[model samples]
Target: MIFFYTARAKFNNENGADILAWTNYIEWSKLTQLTELVSIDTSINEVLVETDRTSEEDWKEIVIDGYHETGFYRTLDHVLKKKILKDLIS
Candidate 1:
């Protein structure tokens, strides 16, 4: 089975067909925050992603375990990179 998730920060276009970014540092439900971002950059952001479903669960574990080391997304700077910048307040 293949699963897809839209992350908060990414390099995507106006349609948001392609999205890529740092996903090793966030929660699952947090993906919703990227919607507005997808709309703003609906013109010039394209990202390529490579995935391995076999490790998806392990990936989640790693992210959770490493949270304390990197901390959480507390600043707008953390989530504003590509079109997603529009979704942020800062």
Candidate 2:
């Protein structure tokens, strides 16, 4: 199944460059925190993702196992993105 996620950074009155720089600096390892934040299954296949990056918005494709069997979509959204960013920064 195909899943979409919007990645965002929390910057205080920062310009586009700052935000984009912050996002680019984000590590992929930090993103794995979603497995617990969203309660994702570890048995899922290797994730296939497509990222559309821009200064303002960053959209990503996430492939998770059991996306169809479970209501996984319920946990994947803007909130999840915010949490990921938070986890990345903190």
Candidate 3:
């Protein structure tokens, strides 16, 4: 199961306001949705930061199908949660 975090903006422009108010909202979604968005807009790759989840064969297949090409390949070293917390506190 692949999961991803998406951060988006909520805007309010009620009562004929001259300016817009916006708030940042974050949510979690499955890989399927992400692939759908990618299929619609390939430009998303500019801001996409994929993690180590692509290393698995099943995950890789889904990504390749979504991307419609095999050229976009990347790998990053996986990190442990304990090490991440230790670094954060120190």
TM-score of each: 0.16, 0.18, 0.19
Evaluated at residue 48, the lDDT of candidate 3 is 31
Q: Report the lDDT tens digits of candidate 3 across residue range 17-80.
A: 2232111111233232221232323333222332345556425432354646433332232223
The weakest ten consecutive residues by lDDT in model 1 span 69-78
Model 1: per-residue Cα lDDT over 1-90, one tens digit each: 532232333432334344343232123437645543432232423322212237543244222234341212223332233225434534
Which 10-residue window in model 3 sums to the lowest lDDT? Answer: 17-26
lDDT at position 9, candidate 3? 19
Clashes of 1: 5
Query: lDDT for each of the candidates?
Result: 0.32, 0.36, 0.31
Q: Which pairs of residues collide in model 1?
A: 12-45, 13-45, 14-41, 14-42, 14-43
Q: How much is 68 displaced in model 1, in angstroms?
A: 25
Candidate number achieving the greatest lDDT relative to the actual structure: 2
Q: Note the residue pairs that clash in candidate 2.
A: none
Give the better candidate number (2 or 3) by lDDT: 2
Model 1 deviation from native, Cα RMSD in Å:
15.2
1 or 3: which has the higher lDDT?
1
Cα-based RMSD of candidate 2: 15.4
lDDT of 3: 0.31
